[model samples]
Target: MRLLEGVLIVVHIFWLLSFLFRFNAKVKISTNLVAFILMMIHFEAEGHRWQMGLTYVLFIFLTLLILKPFIQRNSKKVKLDSENKKKVKKFCGILFILIYSISSFALVIMMPVFQLPKPTGPFEVGMTSRHLIDESRSQNTISKQEAREIMIQIWYPAEVTDDNQKIQYEAFPYEEWSGTMEFIFSFPRFFFNYLKYNESNSIKDITVSDQESKYPILVFSHGFGSTRMQSYSQMEELASHGYFVVSVDHTNDAGYTKFPDGREVMNRADAYSYSFNIEDEKDVKTRSRDVSFVVDQLTKINKQDSQKLFTGKMDIDRIGVFGHSYGGSTAAQVLLDDPRFLSGINIDGPLHEPVASSRLKKPFMFILDDDYLFLTDEEIKYTNVTPEEFREYHNKITELADFHYEEGIKNDTYRLTFIAGDHYTFTDFPYLSPLLSLDINVDQFHQVMNQYILAFFNQYVKGEKTDPILLKEKKVDEFYYFETNIKN
Candidate 1:
């Protein structure tokens, strides 16, 4: 909880305890009113969240207590003179406060309104979005006029000076982004209404940096049923280091996307995107086309930008692509199908079909989540599956992973196994809510991860000197496996 919110909660508890201890009427009334005032201050200053619902209710009860004296001013009141009655009153009041406090504290801890970490780079970050429609490809048959629509957002290094404030303030939408994530995770919609308090690091529609002639480009695709900005931290980090990054929201495939015109699009992909079969491959193939379309549009923008903000600024020849989960597979697909992508990275994603079987010619980094990489016999024993079914499912998944590791490692691939890290760790989600995010220290992990990412792209896409972090296995946080395609 924030400072004022925390203070209000503590004050409320004290107010309850004061009544139980037979404090004077003025003392009790004053404390209760103080709590009520603090709550108002918290609502206006720190912002009220649903987590404070119980706190609000508790304060209302105190308000009723304060009004009870006035309501019963004419009625005869009998005091509880017995010691047993006084003890019972104290016990119940303490118990009630304890339960309410614990419940409210848990909610605040689980879903906090946090801020994105600052990018550890020299330049500031600027962002902008574009709504794209592919006229040739029809998306929905129910709507006769609708076509394949995509939302593309870009982040780039920017200049912030006295004359030019390349930092345009953009309001964070509590319903839109939070609702999208809740839909993906099956959480109740509007449960995270407090997300509006979360601060974004990128400023919108800002001027691009001109410190260099042209900025190398990095294109991004999100995980299945995930929004493109779900991984905004990495985008900002890259942009702050002088890289122009564009993220594509595969409309109808993303969890949710709202265009400038107020049209809302939600995921139309199969619920089981990780089926590890031909279905998964077909999904990857379809989403890869969106990335391709985005790339084509960027090329056009570089030549003639309608916005008149960034014209001929993209270094098209030095382009790279990276993604997480299913989008990771899309990156591999781009490395194979699109020659414009000089390099790529895959974060904890399983590759499917021809892409899995094909050798990647470009330099690529494969970051794997090793949380379940190894399991003991007892750990393997299932809670809800027959041993045979478990073995088959486990074997097939392992075979899928082995294919990517063996085939991908045959080329110039840098494979890093994140120890105890999970799929969401590769993105900005890890820093959003500590309880739902990764177990790792998010800022530290991202600091190291961003360094390696910058080094890999710099070396392959820009033909720059390689950073030593990529030279061999080293430990800055925890021990994890690291290797290259070439044998030492």
Candidate 2:
């Protein structure tokens, strides 16, 4: 248990004692002591000024109550003052009730709200993913390749009605996983307790009649060591607007993950225990194959499930892939290796894979970090990659790609450099805690990335009209830069 929870429990015990022993003459002194203790715990737990003010008021009242009898003891002892005793009992009873109720209420109310913000639109997303689907089938294969298990979350547009079909934000099975994440992120264990309240409609396996519509299917993979729902703000927003989005959580690589069955997978703590090396790239290739497995399953599921929303809505030809961090790198590799993917967008991942050196004919764009892109000619002169290696890496995409910087203006074309965006800024960490957002300015950074990503996918995948915001040179806040892929 966290220190906060322990303090809260102590406060509750003291308040209970106060309620039970309020009438005892000696108990009045102890009641005041407990009130002081409660006040101290409440002050530390809440840090809110109003809570402090209430604590001060309660302390004063308890102090007066403790003193009232002592100050009148001599005068009252000389006579059997029944009326005075009754009056004192009634006063103490009200005082104890008031202080105890306020303290209890504050404990319940002042605690933080912990939830990854749901998308601000109408969508019910349900996802179930399996990591390393091939491994389960490859029981006889003795290949020592590190295959990743994955958790997948699917988001879809739900029919809004009077009926409640809400999906849960965090499932019961994920409770222990949350505890593990608390340790990983250096947060208090109880920090995720409030996630219990994040209730939403579940994604029903009902069928849709949009067989003739041919909606574009979008596949999303989060960065390595991140949950599938890590980008909820962006994924939910996309689904709410009509696209079917599936987010895959790479097993062992995610902070926490649960397979479709009863199995759960967590991050490999030892994977990064020592010095980071090129073997990391091989692990990435393993993750890339997982993406292909998800796509393969979805393609088949879309064809077979005649009684589900995803039955025939997928326009396989209109499919696209996008991801952040290592996931971005995976998308790039998958697009290159798999012909099933038509278009791909990579956000802030370098092309360091050996296979990445091979040319990709696919129409893809890279939204790279500013620092990585603005490497000066002089810097390159000192580096191993000649202008030719850089050219081969950046100049091979078919539809052209944009290398965005944090300082560039938003452009109408698909490519633009964006500034102030950190690697983790494009995830759900911003909406979870203001402290986290301040630590990295995740809110402004992710909002900008999500907006542009949506616009980009909408234009190319759904054939929607390009928004003019894409062409404008603008800064949403102090922390973002934009850049685009260019044709060499």
lDDT, residue 122, candidate 2: 46
lDDT of 2 by residue, 1-488 (tens): 22443454445445445644655766667666766676576556533333234445555765776687778877745655598886897687767666766674554445433444456544454433333355543211124554434556666665534367443343422344354455356566455655444333334443332324656778887765667766666776777666778887766666666655766555655322311222246657766777788777778767875435566766777778888767777777787678877667877665544434445555565665544333456745654566676555444321123322211213223444555545556665544445444545554565566677777777767778866665555543455544443332
Per-model CA lDDT versus the true structure: 0.76, 0.57
Winning candidate number (lDDT): 1
TM-score of each: 0.90, 0.63
Q: Which pairs of residues have clashing backbones in candidate 1?
A: none
In model 2, which regions exceed 4 Å deviation?
A: 1-111, 114-132, 135-149, 161-183, 186-191, 199-212, 271-280, 306-309, 368-418, 439-444, 472-477, 485-488
Cα deviation at 105, candidate 1, in Å, is: 1.8
Residue 182 of model 2 has an lDDT of 59
lDDT of 1 by residue, 80-193 (tens): 569887778778888998997788777777677677788878888888888888887767634565678888889998877666633554545455566577656777767767
Best by TM-score: 1
Tell me the alpha-carbon RMSD of every candidate: 3.4, 10.5
